[model samples]
Target: MSFHKYIFHYRFSGKSDKPLILFLHGFMGNIHEFDEAISLLTDEFYCLNIDLPGHGKTKILDDDCYKMPKIADALINLLNELQIERCFLIGYSMGGRLALYLTLKFPQRFHKIILESASPGLITDRERLERVKRDEQIARKLARSVEKDDFRKFLDNWYNQQIFGNIKNHPHFEQMIENRLQNNPKKLAKSLQLMGTGVQPSLWDKLKENKKPILLLVGENDSKFVEINRKMFAVNQLCKLKIIKKAAHNIHLENTFIFIENIRNFF
Candidate 1:
């Protein structure tokens, strides 16, 4: 529905009386990103999932909406429109970064937060500039992959990243790719260019100041994020880090049961 400058595609499930958990998907992911996890959690929590700008059916009225701060404001506006005073949050990858921003920027609006395979963004200007260039190249590739077969090829190459570990071997890997194919490559490219990690302000400095209960979930196989979360835990006394065994970057998809178990225990 219409939420100020953006038209969002969102889904609400479970009983309204239950504690609400707002889920934000990763880059290239849609509102259904947490479907499997949400299915199991409906008995305990109400869920709200939405397609962020430049992904799924959500339409952005202004290009400025692609910026992280603007997106955060849009989300807060959405929460107000829904009459949700405070709620739990679960964010994966890009969403996790945004979730952290929201938590730090508007601490009173969230009760607790769960960040999976997430980071606080790059710590240095040089790193951010380099990443921006790399993301630009990737965005060009995504923009060029207009055909189904081309997009499939791009998807295959994407999961091959070591950060993703052995997700390609999962039984539902093909189905996952199919669902991702529903997103428009052109718009996905726009999201990557604008909301990519390079564009987000580093939250490392703000981490030490956070007081809200925070759960950091990283896959055991995803060494990069594990180290990142470890650093995050070291800085914040209220943050808890749980490394999911045998999973990689996309823990929710790679090991749904354990992912849900962590959510149950944490939230």
Candidate 2:
């Protein structure tokens, strides 16, 4: 309950009187991922970017901290420590999933929520099992890479996935890789084991229960998530879906200008 007990590294920017915008980065990403967006929106909102557990400067104390709900709890504690009663949230990919979980569990804490390329977890038990297996395989590979002290290969394979095809060729590609490489492989592997979509509880049934306005952003090129969000929108009229043109999984990075514009319009 007390967030001060956790040592999450965070950066708060902009005027205190402005509405707060909490930015959550995806896996293998740090708080700096939102630097560009934060810079543009600082005049209007106070941006609080935190490095999630197992990634960035935040160190994981217990293995259980990597679980989805626990991560959400930590965020709640963070808000308490920052004295933020309520704030807008923007999460990218893995962080978006976590954001959804948080909103589902603590709806009153958020004003508006934006999810980029996130899902509500696997629906059926069979689908969940399959996803768990796939995630386990990837986690094992990451663990092996960590043992060998070669996280670069893990990152290379991760970014090489078809979903991120649009990002690999971008000019910031090298810098992105470098930023991911800074993460501790062992913690990241543990994170995948605990917080992976396969292990997290499905929120499909809870979608209609969400009262706060939700914006679901997906890249046009990321067909998988686009379809997922489409289905999500169909089920929840409160949710709105926006497709980023020519962008893939990481829309904030792939098409930042449009991404910021979308956020501005949404807010």
Candidate 3:
């Protein structure tokens, strides 16, 4: 669907009568990010999977559309267009942060939410500024990755981060990288510049205002987000935190069964 300069590539599947689940993917992921999970959930859930701005086949006409608030509005409009009054939401990594923003901004549009490896963004200006610089550096690298090999190398290093925690060792890791290579590196740079956590608004103060139920999923191996989500759970009365065993930032890819189990049990 095209909204202004943003063209969102999405797939809506399963029975119309079933409850809907809006699945948002992490950075470098497309609408197929949760395909395996969605395949298993088809009997019980109507899934709406979208290629977030700058990823997959989704095209961003204006860079402004990549901003958190702007993208959130676009998503709400998409739901309205689909005639979905309310639905369950699941977000992973970057998408998780966006899901949280959508939940807080348009709580009535969502029933329940599951945030996997997400945060409320940086707390203070200094932290945000520092993060912005870091993201810019990474963005520059992405922009320079015009060649397929360059992009592949970048992806390799990305998963090597401690937060990703052994994801590269997975049997299908090469396939995952192949999928990521489909994205336009320059466009991804724009997304990282505008939608990165450093640039997004801090949801820390707004967390307590959420009235809907929230499930915070974090992998035990990813201690950084574990602590972040732990603090989130502490602040929000309706939020529940679950630390998945033998996984890290990309929990769904690392432990698909447990990830699906949590979704079923939570929603």
Task: Name model 2 segments beyond 4 Å from true.
Answer: 1-5, 147-149
Q: Compute each candidate's TM-score over C-alphas.
A: 0.98, 0.95, 0.98
Model 2 pairs in collision: none
Candidates' C-alpha lDDT:
0.93, 0.87, 0.93
Task: Write model 2 residue lDDT over 24-100, tens digit each, in one string.
Answer: 99988998887777888889998999898888888666888888888898889778877888999999999999999
The TM-score measured for candidate 2 stands at 0.95
> Higher lDDT: candidate 1 or 2?
1
Deviation in Å, model 2, residue 31 alpha carbon: 0.8
lDDT (Cα, tens digit) per residue for candidate 3, span 118-174: 999999999999999999999999999999999999998898899999998998788
Collision count of model 2? 0
Candidate 2: lDDT over CA atoms? 0.87
Task: Flag regions of model 3 displaced more than 4 Å.
Answer: none
